[model samples]
Target: MGRKKNQAMSVAETDREFVLGAAARLFRQKGFDKTTVKEIAEACGMLPGSLHYRYPSKESILVDLMRLALEQASGSLSEAIKGECDPLEQVRLGINAHLELLVGGSDKVYVLLFEWRSLHGASRQEMIDLRDRYELLWSAMLKSLSSQGLIRADVDRDLLRLIGLGALNWVATWFNEDGRYTVKDIGDFVWAVIKDGVIKR
Candidate 1:
């Protein structure tokens, strides 16, 4: 009986991922406001009613997708900074991880970026909290840099973080997947400007 229950749970988990992946693609292509439950259902090869059993409403699915996107990005950044003590190297690793997250997971990241207005109430706050946690990683790194005299002591930590993350997030808007710069190259360029401008010579 326990084995049967485990198999059932596994199947449900697989179906949920399938629906989320399908919804992410549709949300990116059609815009969250325009994508329909029926379309998502079709994409997942399920009936509309069946899709409802998995996700009660389109908004619910979107909230989960955005949450997942943020979680993945946070995980990427945390992993990139593991065991790194150099503040500048940590910043570089963070930039590279973030750019790679946007490029490699464009579908989910686009949903997170472009569908903010579509979210509301608890779901919106949840995403914000997750985003704040990710930003804190940068906050700590910047603080360390300042304490170590690598960053300008006069710099406002909050504003510095705002500019750094804001500029990095903008990469999703214009970065060309097939263009000259790879993810690491973009990270290098951003870090170069940041390092030269702020780091003590």
Candidate 2:
């Protein structure tokens, strides 16, 4: 009726596995409209009652899944760029960190991206706010470049940020580890696109 007893996994580890593996997989496969809390609990090796004790609704699980994705990704990007003074390098590392998380195939993040629209009411608004907060990381990174005059004055920094992130996030849908381009390479290409317009050199 509860989480397994005396397990080697800590609460945080189990939660990560739940979001990254079992619950994420279930949500990704069946979708929020179709997935049940009972199924999620069973997948995580807990009883349905225990799952309810933790998350009253599937939307709550979705909310936490998204919250964790943003938190972890934001933390990683921030740490990756820490103490690096070059705005260009920060942009490179930040974009690379974002792609690495995406292409690493974290099902938790996948559900966050694909199933965010499934959230509703307070849950939806909560996620939107959290997502925007997370986005400020990227916004600030782009703005840093603009302040240094690395980007053109005529370029709409907000538009570039939105389009650049959209393009990078979509990489998860088609990226392959077995492919020629590593995640870093993809980041490089994307940054190059932003830095240099797609004109023939």
Candidate 3:
């Protein structure tokens, strides 16, 4: 037989991708606190020792998953708003980008939303700092909109940032592929609500 392709995959891109994906699924299905490194190894079709060599601990896998999630969400939002100068349209596209993550984004992204409390100590703070950094992307954009008078002068951009994200994140709890609302429908309704209530008339 030719040299086995799978033999070389143990330390390559395939291993990392497969391990992270399997770990993400297990995290979502079993909850991060309950899932074990051995289980993640089994899910990856690799030995626990091999996984331990890469991750060392279960928390290490979680931190990586959350980091991956933040990158995906932030990147999606940034790409959606790129080339758009209209503050109103920028906000609309941004809202759609966020909502899209609930449906189209990876299991790691979902894990980030629901499993973040699993981390403790330095890991928890690291995730928090990264999350805050992601939120600042929106904070800056919102401030720009407010300064341009596109947002209501009385509206608190800080509150809007917090409350807006809360509302968007909440969609993941009830959103379903078979539900009455499509992602676009949810996006449109959310944008409408923001436009009517928050944007300057």
Candidate 4:
């Protein structure tokens, strides 16, 4: 019985992943305002009416996409923090993982960050809450570093968190794998500014 239950859970997980991936790509290419259920269905190679079987509405797809993105970001951060006790190194790893996602999952990250507000009512609020939770993880990590005297005493935790997130968020707009700076280079550069400030040592 337990084995059967586990298999059922695995199948459900796979199905949700498929729906979220399709929605993420469509939303990123077309923007949430422009993307429709029919378009997503076509992208997934399903009939227009078939999407309704998996998602009740286009808004639901947006919500699922945002949720999946957040989940991935959270998992990345959690992995980075594991076995690393140094606050500064943890912060560096967090930023690196975030930029990697922004570069690799650019389309989905773009949609999650920019088009999430298009969801209405409860859906919008739920996505916002999930986003806030993800942001709080970074904020908390920064705050912990400050308390340990690793970060500058004058650095504002909230402002630092915002700058880190804002910097990484823009990667989807301007990042090029062939560009002058690699993803790690960009992540390190942003971290240096956030950690040591622009002023000379």
Each model's number of backbone clashes?
Answer: 0, 0, 0, 0
lDDT of 3: 0.87
Judge candidate 1 against the unseen true structure and give its global Cα lDDT, from 0 to 1.
0.87
TM-scores of all candidate predictions against the true structure: 0.89, 0.86, 0.90, 0.90
Residue 22 lDDT, candidate 3, scale 0-100: 95
User: How far in Å is the alpha carbon of 43 misplaced in model 1?
Assistant: 1.2
Please give the lDDT score at residue 130 for candidate 4.
93
Q: What ranges in model 4 sit over 4 Å off?
A: 198-201
Query: By TM-score, how accurate is candidate 1?
Result: 0.89
Cα lDDT for residue 162, candidate 4: 78
**lDDT for 101 (candidate 2):** 88
lDDT per residue for candidate 4 within 105-165, as digits (tens), equals: 5466778878856878899899879989999888888877777767766667788677768
Which is the winner by lDDT between candidate 1 and candidate 2?
A: 1
Model 2 TM-score, all chains together: 0.86
lDDT of 1 by residue, 93-193 (tens): 88898888877756888888889999989988988998899899889998888888888877788998898888888888888878988787888888889
For all candidates in order, the CA lDDT equals: 0.87, 0.81, 0.87, 0.81
Model 3 steric clash pairs: none
